[model samples]
Target: MVSFTASAQYGKQKKADTLFNKFSFVKAAEVYKELIENKYNEDYAVRRLADCYALLRDVKNAAKYYKKAVKQDNVPIEYYYNYAQALRGVEDYKGSREWMRRYKDSGGVTSTKNFGKDGNFITSIFNAKQQYFLSKVNFNSKLSDFGAYEHNGKVYFASTRDEGVSVKRLYGWNEQPFLDVYVTEKGSKDPVDHKAKLKGDVNSIYHDGPVAITKDGTTMYFTRNDFFKNVQEKDKKGINNIKIYRATLKDSVWTDVEDLPINNSEYTTQHPALSSDGKKLYFASDRPGGFGGSDIYAVDINEDGSLGTPENLGDVINTPGAEGMPFINNEGTLFFSSDGHVGLGMLDIFATVADKDNKIIDVINLGVPVNSSKDDFSFFMGEDGLTGYIASNRSGGMGDDDIYAYNRVPLLNVEGVVTDAINKKPIANAIITLLDGNNRQIAYMETDEEGYYEINIDRDVDYNITASQKKYEDDSESFTTKNIETKVTTITKNLELNPVQDVVILAELNTIYFDFDKHNIRPDAALELDKIVNLMLNEYPGMVIRIESHTDSRGDLTYNDKLSIDRANSTYEYLISKGIDPARITEHQGFGERRLTNGCDGSVNCEESNHQLNRRTEFIVIKMK
Candidate 1:
């Protein structure tokens, strides 16, 4: 909990202020720390110390001082937001939310307020599949090696790595050697010797490079400080604003270097990215009428190699905090770094999702491992989208900023066929349900006529695949994918469902009997007949049945035949009335006393139960599929 101050009344305070205003954050931080130690203007020095760490992407120290700065009276409202972001960098999300609440209460427009409406957002981000496996590239140095882009099988990047010389000039902001564009053999084994300066005049003595190249590899767009023709230009604050420049490749070397018309001495416009079709150029700028310290803008690349007016991407992509370092992939997805969005910390990379009309509709955070608490920017994806590179200033890197190669685990490609177990025949229109280990449904589809199904699923997850069809038993199989190694893997999983057991097996019904010498259905008999009607309507819609009625041996043959026929007709009418289609009842007949259950055909003594069975109607399943 340290504190400091700066006041115009002191000479040392004025010198620190001059350096701070010039963007010399590192040297300015040193002076601010000394002032705080000496107790000279403690209030202003404390807040400025936090600002220095924040700008340097040193989240831990930034959070430490910002905590103290926010407690002081008359603190600016934006300090609350900076403190909140610093808290997020340290993974203190609860503390971040509190400070963000205060910032919003004080009339600050922030993404935190928008994120608060969805309680599961943070959990969803963390719980999402970890699709990428990242490894540090070999050529990273102990300086700032970052901004990797690939073109024509060669990798190009911007780095402050020393070129085997002493007495090199350093940028005052970071006290590092000025950045220069460099090239290396793609996937080179000799990281030291294969790395060399780019084959072009684009690299300047001042900060240069981190470039974008068109698909044809004939043109390049790059960023550089406003220094040209052996002269450096400065704006009102004595700072050289950055600008974008275009260059052409010819005769195996880049030439025809020229500054783009979008450059303005009063503001910064840098970090160029060309669209896949080479018709649009996207870049970051802090020119007038921007929403924040910086915002992303786009300009049309005309047919004659000229440029059109710049268009701001609008408030959806820009916020009150800085947004910059845009990269557009071949699929037209815009990946950019932003500190304004609610994220894990200070500059997280977000990819835009656009509609079919090519208008950006949503932005998605590329959660952890790719993004860290420190600044992560400069994302480039290959055509397959699974292989890519990103730059991060987080710890365990070879430098202040290092490039990491990443491979996204491709979705598991699956196709299968479902069939009837007994006949080995395809089962059409069968429902296939896919569930996770938690039994939550992930996806579902109906099998085609060929009983074939195809779907893609996430890797390294447990799943249950189920197949179900009418008149068949449900079949399910458990599948688990673990540690699969491939760019894209295809698997086949076949399922066989057994047809339901015979319909007669469900015929264990109560004895459906008629009264002695009666041709009508009794109230008790109707209840039993309803069971047959229900089974036909619900379980087996295609079942065809026949009704048979018999009489006890106590009746005469002629009388029994007439009574049995009437009883059979009564059962048929009842089934039809219950919505069982008449077409499904193939026949109705009277068996009289011919089909006796026992020796109760007027020739032997039998119990009353035996007689009741002989006086019953029967539902025979003629056909079932």
Candidate 2:
């Protein structure tokens, strides 16, 4: 091996390679940039600089350097991948896929369909309906600012604002001041003027910020540079990695700053987001055995206040690229930023919907205004869940990275429990549906074991929440979210469905009146039969019913039998036409005036009312499944 230790240029080259290997892209780019500006290592420096920008999702800069970074032969396959992604970020689809194809041919995945020109990635996200209306916050400065959170009546964020004495000491990487923790009163008309940096204990001379507060607001776990207590330690490359620190609030003062157990100096561990119960702390780390350069991890916040071993989120959420900046909303959604996922070619925000048991139900990207073809990260939402802030280096920002506030029109959700009216006990497995003002079904879901169901509704619309179950009468309630003016964000509705009647015999049926021995069903008869039809179809969706028709003894037995059969067939056909499944009809037959009530079997004269009773048609539950 040649010894290049005597050369200054070789020493810098080795340092840049070390930084890049450790995933310190921001500083690695700076080191590579110096090598290129001085012409010390133009060929190697240009390619490595572009690689650093690509990994950090600075796509525009990555593309710029990538134009000059190509080598004729023996180039690493990842260079093709980075150039392809950077090209896509600038909307140059044709150029992107050319390099993407090269990546596929060079020991990458054989299928280039995902990043190809014909890919549906952009079209899918662009065609989606906008979920939120974003407004750039007023407090963004001409430096990097991001990761805003709310507690009590104040908003806390990480910013490179000039208030900190460390502001004068710019970082060697981005040329911005070291990140410091800052706070301001929430919902202020001009929060920038009120923004103040945290005290010495919290905001140190090095990078500090992006904190996670507990539910009670008494404790917080934050991220800061590993230079604490004047004991600055570095790796083989002499670069100090990040660490997670815990601080407690006492009498409105944050103190007792201490290092968390999960921190590792060999790698970066930062971006702490505490669970709603403060029992688990979710964070982003570059630790080994991860699916990506960085992956979101979670550790138990033990009952005694010590930390447990970190667990990776899993393969579903982490890819082989960088993923960081994790935040868990009050409802247990894990929101994080990732360049690994298929998005608009930059860092895009995504979320994992979780149930109370912490099982992930779905993963979704927060598309469009919340995501652009630029580096967007550090997403945070407020207590209301509608108002929030994000960080982006997208076009027309006030700084290298600017903070943007997004206020979504509260997605009006209505949820409740279904229970028994008599015993007031939960009704599980009940089918619940929601309808709009026009009576169109908007959504439907089944009640869980605890009889809980939730659904979102459109704003300024009236809704009818209905619950149904076998052997139960359907119950419904009407609610309107129109003109609420944010006074009511969610509606709680409980439904108590009543049980249907146990059974009905033939005598209970309405009169089967016909005009002068005619067998056709009259309008009055149709109305009467409808009640039975509803009972069979709705009350017992799986039950089959037998339809029986009777006739008066005034006609011959053969003719009467034929006429009675006609009446039964006509009634059965009507039920079928009304959406009652034909397979649900067990029998449709006529008795032909046999065994008539009141002994009116043609041997004696009977009153009209008594004859009407004999002419009646009825049903009996024959089968159930």
Model 2 segments more than 4 A misplaced: 1-42, 52-58, 68-71, 93-98, 109-118, 163-167, 189-195, 354-358, 410-625
Candidate 1 global lDDT: 0.84
The superposed Cα distance between candidate 1 and the true structure at residue 48, in angstroms, equals: 1.2
lDDT of each prediction vs. the true structure? 0.84, 0.78
Provide the lDDT at 247 for model 2: 87
Model 1, 1-625: lDDT tens digits are: 2323224336677888888888789999999998888878787999999999998888999999999999999999999999999998887877887888899899988764445733555676788777778998988888888789998888889998866766688888888989888888789866542138777778888998899999888999999999766678888877899999888999978778887899988899999998889999999999999988899999999999899999999877887888888988877889999988877778899988788898886788898788877888899888777888999988899769999999887557677999877547688999999998999998899999999998878777888999998678899999877676666567778998876755475655455898878878898888887877887776655567788899999878888888889989999998899998898898989988888888888778888778887898887766543
Model 2: pairs clashing at backbone N, Cα or C within 3 Å: none
Q: Which pairs clash in model 1?
A: 4-42, 4-46, 5-41, 5-42, 5-43, 5-44, 5-45, 6-45
Q: For every model shown, what is its TM-score relative to the native structure?
A: 0.73, 0.68
- Find the candidate with the highest lDDT and give its number: 1
